[model samples]
Target chain A: MGRVVVEVMPKPEILDPQGKAVVGALPRLGFTQFTSVRQGKRFELEVDGPVTPEVLAAAEEAAVKVLSNPVIEDVVRVADIEADAAATITSEGLA
Target chain B: MGRVVVEVMPKPEILDPQGKAVVGALPRLGFTQFTSVRQGKRFELEVDGPVTPEVLAAAEEAAVKVLSNPVIEDVVRVADIEADAAATITSEGLA
Candidate 1:
């Protein structure tokens, strides 16, 4: 099985009420270091076969067309889960 | 300024109606490669100063205590955005 991860975030200009609420609540919860918060969406899409480049391309297309509202949100990241794991491992080695 | 990214996902055993709906809709939208879909949450927390270890630690704590509900969600990742960018750059080099 292969999985792709897609992340979508609201446009910076848009007002994010949920984020505002979170930032407001954090201070009360004693996590005062945070100055702002922006809530977004993450999606994991699974396929039966390996995540080929074609699959990733399709996932990216779908991420923009279906998963997010273009007017208000931006597709921030789209990556293969296995590839991401490999990247993390390589990065850890470098670190 | 600094930022931390936190990702939360539904527990494996939990029923995800939104995911189900997405999976059902994918075929209709001509995205037939996907077999399953799971939706989750992503949060970006900003701070006035650089993202220190203490800030990242606080973000992790907040992710568990406030960003996600223990009953149904899991805090999958919490990382400083700048660090993540560095990791990505290193990973790309290896790739």
Candidate 2:
């Protein structure tokens, strides 16, 4: 089991108006220290199977190329990827 | 520093053709045990300020109402939220 994840955020110079709106709405919702909010995105991918050094590299490359914006978003922070399936899959002669 | 995060997944019955494509692409991309893929979306919210019990509650509500589809996506999993600013902000008499 392998998963690729990414974090996306607005460029530092760009204004995050949606974040601002959330922040502005907070006080009324009972938050006082309202200040700044940066909106971002995350992606979760369930991979074909297993995690190896090469597969890890592959996933990272795929993410950068197709899943995320390199200029606006940071590269993925690989986390808790499993290679071994926890449950046993019993196949009658199909191993 | 407050961030509200949510995880979104497609309804089980709805076909996830994109996920299927990714799974099929894996072997070509160098994964051998290629099996399946489930694609999902994650949302990151930077809150106006500190996360209180009430604020936490509010953010969850907003996420359900506007940020996510309650039926298709699970409620946010609030993690590592912070209220204290790490860097010192020297306010010239603006307390």
* Leading candidate by DockQ: 1
Q: Predict model 1's lDDT versus the native.
A: 0.88
**Backbone collision tally, model 2:** 0
In candidate 2, residue B64 scores what lDDT?
Answer: 65
Q: Cα RMSD (Å) per model?
A: 2.1, 12.3
Local distance difference test values of all predictions, in order: 0.88, 0.50
Task: Assign candidate 1 its CAPRI class.
Answer: medium
lDDT of 2 by residue, A1-95 (tens): 66544445566677767667766775676554435555655445554554555655655676676555777765424332221111111110111
* Residue A9, candidate 1: alpha-carbon lDDT: 96
Q: Can you tell me which runs of candidate 2 are displaced by over 4 Å?
A: A15-39, A81-95, B17-37, B81-95
lDDT of 1 by residue, A1-95 (tens): 99998899999999999999999999999999999999999999999988888888899999988999999999987887776667655543533
TM-score (chain A) of candidate 2? 0.65
What residue runs in model 1 are displaced by over 4 Å at the alpha carbon? A88-95, B89-95
Worst 10 residues of 1 chain B by lDDT: B86-95
lDDT of 2 by residue, B5-79 (tens): 444556666677767776677668655443556565544555455555665555556666655566765542433
TM-score of chain A of each: 0.90, 0.65
